[model samples]
Target chain A: MSITREEVLKMAELARLEFSEEELDGFTAQFQGILDYIEQLRQVDVEGVEPTSHVSLSADFDPRMFREDEARESLPVEEALGGAPDPAAGHFRVPKVL
Target chain B: MSLRRIEEADPALGAFLTCDPGRVLERAERVDRDVKERPLPLAGVPVAVKDNICTRGLRTTCGSRMLEQYVPPYSATAIERLEAAGAVVVGKVNCDEFAMGSSTENSALQVTRNPYDLDRVPGGSSGGSAVAVAAGMAALALGSETGGSVRQPASFCNVVGLKPTYGRISRYGLVAFASSLDCIAPLGNSPRDIALLLGRIAGRDPLDSTSAPAPVPDYVAELDRPPGRLRLGVPKEYFGQGLDPEVKAAVEAGIRNAGKLGCDVVEVSLPHTRFAIADYYIIAPAEASSNLARYDGVKYGFRAEAPEDLMDMYRRTRTLGFGPEVRRRIMIGTYALSSGYYDAYYGRAMKVRTLIRRDYERAFEKVDALLGPVSPTAAFRIGEKASDPLSMYLSDIYTVTANLAGIPAVSVPCGFTAGGLPIGMQILGNLFQELPLLRLAQAYIREFPVAPPPLRV
Candidate 1:
């Protein structure tokens, strides 16, 4: 029935987004508004209408069709590695063996 | 370089979790050099990718620190198709950590703000991608919609977001959100661009068996054909609850406009619509928890800052890397799939998911497409609903059904609020029926002019 800033902060931390004290106030108010809004859904009386989950029958929506069975030419070693902040010998080079 | 535009506009807009100026300009330069005789339709177009998609050398972080430094060894099939089509990679945009949240606020990397208002959120888990395109950082972008992740953001950001029919596009290498529920979608300035992008990416792919073998229609061709006499279903369930009065007005406007285009608007009810969100959470998380188990630190991705041993590494890495929402869903999913709970939780949820699909099947039988507000409300100010997770979940109220049903849906900006925030109208069609969706979108776009900019840069 009630939402709290502590929960919001906890949720924000869980979500990995940082909010300054100034911004936390903003999010808390918005979350309340949104929660209050969602309350409207509680008003709909769907006593007999079954809850629907999946909409399309594509469940067996196979992923293999998007699969690449054969290895094809990829971007050049240099081209592919071109964006890495740290790269060595066409492979990404990072801190240590650990 | 386009980096400045985003950097200048993005900090407050929250369009990216990571933006490397040096790398983007370099990619832009390379894209310039690669422009050859091939008239790639989207050549030189900078694209922001949802973090969940594999981008080979990029961090491909999925907005989670668990893989903050992780980079895939291979490219996603959709990304491969885009690059082959000459689309330039701008950067990996933000998302709900592990594609869990409806607002980009769930992003472990950054809180992606909506372009419509700095204070309001851009919808997620594809929120950052939608923001990037709406703010013009990218001419186009790629997003993944398990529920309404892509379309909701597109609606909030005032752009075209398309969740094509399940398998219309390959999911190969898209970091699994909910494998069965997730579909890589297109977010762009307009519907034509989505059609163009879909053409290149759709069709059978060996890498993903779910990729549809159905012929990818020439969406542009359908756009030219008259959309006259088409049955447009307006489901009454979506009009209820949490929907902003202004957004509902906009949906009505969109309907009247389509009516002007000669499409017959009909009142069609998918009676089971209310259960969409509940059924979706159960299934998406059930699948996601199983998918996320793969991210244990020892195998790949982020490791704990200090780990005494392998087990310690898994626990610490996950505990530290995953944000709370991700953990919550993981826990929910774990509980749902656990030994004693599987039948009650996962099993029942799957059956409910089937019923949800059946609802759409029944509705589609009488209508060519369904329409409604993409989200219940227009852009809500940032930090608005982070506290109340229940309220935040409602953001996907209109979108989750499409994913649950495995159909095609597109969000097209129809009107703006009194405050000037965007209101997106959602149009959904049956499985493998992407062309009609695009046609309906294009017809609306012809009246709206939100497509690619009239003046080329």
Candidate 2:
């Protein structure tokens, strides 16, 4: 259950998050403790057990519960982009992918 | 008057992120005008909203700098319903960043103190919501529960908090931490107020498919008919080690009071109770990791100043925007759902979750509801468990099971510690059974009422 600093950094990279050197050291220790604590779940004999990923979704999966997939008015572009950190020409402007 | 109280006391209490007097007055006036036409359930009731629930024009921060200035385009279904039913939203309150922590200390914006003891932490991430009601800043408040957010804070502040049956209330505008576990719950000074608010906000929302299509009952009317001669089970595991003696004693006394109401209080074992925290940690964070992936610097929210590329922007924006605990959860989730470890971690945890749910199902078949302590102990000092995340996580042990099982549960003021800290007794009900659950809460409150915490405010 031990997670090394490299593994921590790798996980951070996957999560699209970064950490400082000090934070990494501190979080790595805290993270390892949490992992170790949750590790107790391994002991449960889960043979033939159905994973309850969602309580309502798993038990009650009626398609009728959802709204009809009808096209309707959406938020106007101005309202939609009102909170955008960076917007340009009715689009969320990001750095060039190329 | 809630606005004036917020202005006067919220400075010291640190309960709100934003409280615009002009908007509050406008909404109140509108409610006043509307009540003339017909009776409203929550007519003119002042409510403080958690920052995570979207309010059309007001900023929805989720207590994270990532969304510090982010204003949503539309309000949540619950908010719209609250307004339509004549509830005046006092303001948006603070919470743990992305509703992650057990204490309000994780709020990047402000530290909300418990109304009972100013130096103690308001159990969170619904600390501000609880503080609002306890200090009379608002009559009721909306707090979202991913783990023990609302109820834990209510327990700390001596108010009442309800985590309704999952999908019993719509999650349309609630900022998702763990989609399956997140519930936009209510906190109030009394169970009667909670019932009133629940009636207004509970029902199917076309916008939120997860919202139950089940008929909404008159919760306030149901309260008139007390839950008579009920079978109340006291889970033995919740009473075991790590429970503070004072809390344990107080809750036992509360169970005894239930017996006075003709309830059959018996000991039951939720064998998988010990594994709840483990299962919850894995599942909640795994879902959180996915839900929060939308916060990349692309659309809205805080963006990094200068990035060489999109990848750099994503990493830097999240790194700078999220707090330490949030980053830790995201990392844990990423690692758990990672290629080589998914089955061992997330998969195993989900199966374990079934065991936890089954434990509740079996107990409910024998007893109408389960009574227990909401938190392991009363509110601790501000920095006591902040440094140790594991210790903080342990405090939520008694609360997470109800959420994991998707059942309704409420925290009512049971008693107080000698140190004058407030303790709460948690009552959990079967799926979609909020009516009887609330009746039990109302009956308990009617029989043994704990005076509201005497705050200097």
Candidate 3:
């Protein structure tokens, strides 16, 4: 169950994070420990048990109570873009992807 | 008055991350003016909120550098309700970075110390909220519990923490960690205070679809009736190894006292209890990985100065913004949900979660409630478990089951350890049975009568 350096790198990439060489080394070791600990789950016999995605739904939960799918007022553009790091004319600015 | 007290006391405790006296005074004055005509349940009471819950126009950091200056545009439904009830917002308290760790040590902003012993941690990620109540800085506090965040800290600080059934309270503006497990809870000095806060905040919200449409009960009124011959289950797995002997003794004494109070204590088994941590780690991170993907550099929060490309910006921003613990969790979650490994990790964890839930269902069939220790031991020194993450995760063994089962649970001060640190006993009830849970806690508190932490500024 030990995770490799390549695997850690892949995970960091997938998570949109970068690690230094020292941090990568440390994380590799720690991930091994955590994964090993998590490996204990394999011991449980989960043959036909249904996976529970939401604990609140096991008993009394309803979906029909959700708000009607009618159109509603949304946040004003200025308020919506208030926290943006870089903003153009009524839009969030990001680095060129093309 | 509360601001003055907090100003004098909070420097010693490091409980609050942000406090606005101007806003608080304005709110208090409005409450005073309104109260002459109609009664407000929490009129003029000062309430501190955990930094993770959103408050309009205030910085809600979630104790992370990423959100160091992030001000939420709208308030949480819980906070709106509390404010309507005339509770004054004191400030936003500290917590672990995104409520990830068991101790407040993981806070990227600052460490919140235990009010009882400055050398020890106040438990987390609701550490600051618990400390605020324990030190009399605020009359009540709002804390979110993904695992044992609320109850564990309440145990450490000798306060009352109530985590109602999942979806009992709205999670509209709560910064999501583990969506299925997260619950907005209340921490206070007394069960009555906790009940009052819970009654005000517990109900369905159109904003959060997951919130249950169940009718809110008069939790404060529920305390009047003496709990009559209630069947209490003592889960055998909780009393097993790794439990501090002092905590075990205190909880057992509390159980015995419950028997004296006409509660029929019986031994019960939750056989799949051992797998909770593993299951939790997998499922929580899997959800977190999805939830936190919104924190890229473009829209909000901290962004790196400049980057060669968008991908580099994203990587650098996340790496520098999040702390080690958060990064570790993200990595674990990403791996779990990755293409080749989803079934082996996240899928298996989900099945185990079902087994854990079933165990609680079976136990509740014969018993009205279950009782156990809130944490394995009393509060540890600040840096005691910082190096060992697994050991830190294990400390939440007894408390996480309630969250896993989506049941209502409360922690009330049972006794003090030999070292003079406080120990709390947890009472768990079936889904949406918060009234009975609060009643049981109130009765125990009446008998034990916990003393406030001796924090003199």
RMSD of each: 6.7, 1.1, 1.1
TM-scores for all candidates: the values are 0.83, 0.98, 0.99
Query: Can you tell me which runs of candidate 1 are displaced by over 4 Å?
Result: A1-98, B20-34, B448-457
Candidate 2 regions off by >4 Å? A60-63
lDDT of 3 by residue, B221-266 (tens): 8876887779999999999999999999999998998778788989
Which has the higher lDDT value, candidate number 1 or candidate number 3?
Answer: 3
lDDT of 2 by residue, A1-98 (tens): 79999999899888988888977788888899999999998899999988888887665434468677899999999999898889999999998789
TM-score of chain A of 2: 0.91
Q: What is the lDDT of residue B69 in candidate 3?
A: 93
Q: How far off is residue B453 in model 2, in Å? A: 5.4
- Model 3 agreement with the true structure over A10-75: per-residue lDDT tens digits: 998899998889888888998999999999999999999999999766657776666988999988
| TM-score, predicted candidate 1 vs. hidden true structure | 0.83
Per-candidate DockQ vs. reference: 0.12, 0.80, 0.86
Best-fitting candidate, measured by DockQ?
Answer: 3
Which has the higher DockQ value, candidate number 2 or candidate number 3? 3
User: What is each predicted model's overall lDDT from 0 to 1?
Assistant: 0.76, 0.91, 0.91
Chain B TM-score by candidate, in order shown: 0.95, 0.99, 0.99
